[model samples]
Target chain A: GQQVMQIPQYQHVQEGEDFTTYCNSSTTLSNIQWYKQRPGGHPVFLIQLVKSGEVKKQKRLTFQFGEAKKNSSLHITATQTTDVGTYFCAGIMIYNQGGKLIFGQGTELSVKP
Target chain B: EAGVAQSPRYKIIEKRQSVAFWCNPISGHATLYWYQQILGQGPKLLIQFQNNGVVDDSQLPKDRFSAERLKGVDSTLKIQPAKLEDSAVYLCASSFQTGMAAFFGQGTRLTVV
Candidate 1:
């Protein structure tokens, strides 16, 4: 079975500070996706990374996929209170004629204004 | 476009009771998934369906959990003889064919006492 592990189970940062979370997988993934879930809300798709050593940016956030396709990272520059939430990385794997997603434990971000 | 829809945003039940939750995926989406998310953790896939056929249920506890997607549109998840550890948020998501991103519903919060 594939498993994804995330570092920094919890993070507390002041407004305007920077934050980053790393995700690692036990096996190579076909693709990786990032999601954000606010308190009392459902997970929302943030972005997806497929190519090895790929990097994508959205406004103040940057996402990177490792060269080996077994790791990824999400970095937020100048965090704000609105950035407070849990971030998750999910790895997609195909086996036995089907696909499955393995999600990391998640990183809970707390931003104080 | 409408997102995935789930019924009974919250549920409270005694241990040993049975409870069910329903989900309606977005129109034309071919893939639907059910995930269980506990506090401080990422969502874990419970089941996946591709147009009314079961694709994967490897992580599901078949002894007490069951899910079905009839007509390839709406789906339901049932838990019988629930235990206190069954408390969590159940999320439903749908994605278009061939590697599209998933859209999630608000989720059903279940509390077993």
Candidate 2:
């Protein structure tokens, strides 16, 4: 069984500050994806990282996959009020037969203006 | 193209009652997944389906939870004799391929009293 863990279960930041959430998996993943969920809303697809040591950016947010494919991170620069939400990481194992997806517990972010 | 569709955005039932949630994934999507998300936590994978076939149900509580995807289009999740801990949001997502971006539907929020 694969398990994904996230750090900083809760994070609070002021406007214009930066925020980052880390994700770790017990097994080597073939690919990792990130998602965001606003309060009282459904989860939305954000990004996916496949190659090891890969880095991708979207506007003010950056996503990175570890070289060993066992971890990932999401960093948001200059957070705003609208950036408040929970971030989740899902990992897909390389040798998974049934395509089991393991999701991290998520990091809840709150931004104060 | 339509996104994943779910019925009964909300539900409230007694602890011993049974409840069922329905989901219709996006057209042409072969992979479907059901996740349970508790308050203050990320989505947990409950089951996955690939064209009406069960791919993964390792995390599903088999004693009380069951799900089915018929005709490879629509799916349903059932919880019999539900417990208070069953209060959470159930999300349905679909993807065109494995390890690809998944689009989630508006979840069904269930409250077991």
In order, the Cα lDDT scores of the candidates are: 0.92, 0.92
What lDDT tens digits, residue by residue, belong to model 2 across residues A1-113? Answer: 57899998999999999999999999889899999999999889999999999999999999999999999999999999999999999998654355666789999999999
Q: For each candidate, what TM-score against the reference?
A: 0.97, 0.97
Which pairs clash inside model 1? none
Per-residue lDDT over B1-113 for candidate 1, one digit per residue giving the tens place of the 0 to 100 score: 99899998999999999999999999999889999999878999999888899888999999999999999999999999899999999999998852468899999999999
Give the Å shift of residue B9 in candidate 1: 0.8
Going through the candidates in order, state the TM-score of chain A alone for each one: 0.97, 0.96
The ten-residue window of minimal lDDT in model 2 chain B covers B50-59
lDDT of 1 by residue, A1-113 (tens): 67899999999999999999999998888899999999988889999999999999999999999999999999999999999999999888776656777689999999999
RMSD of each: 1.1, 1.0
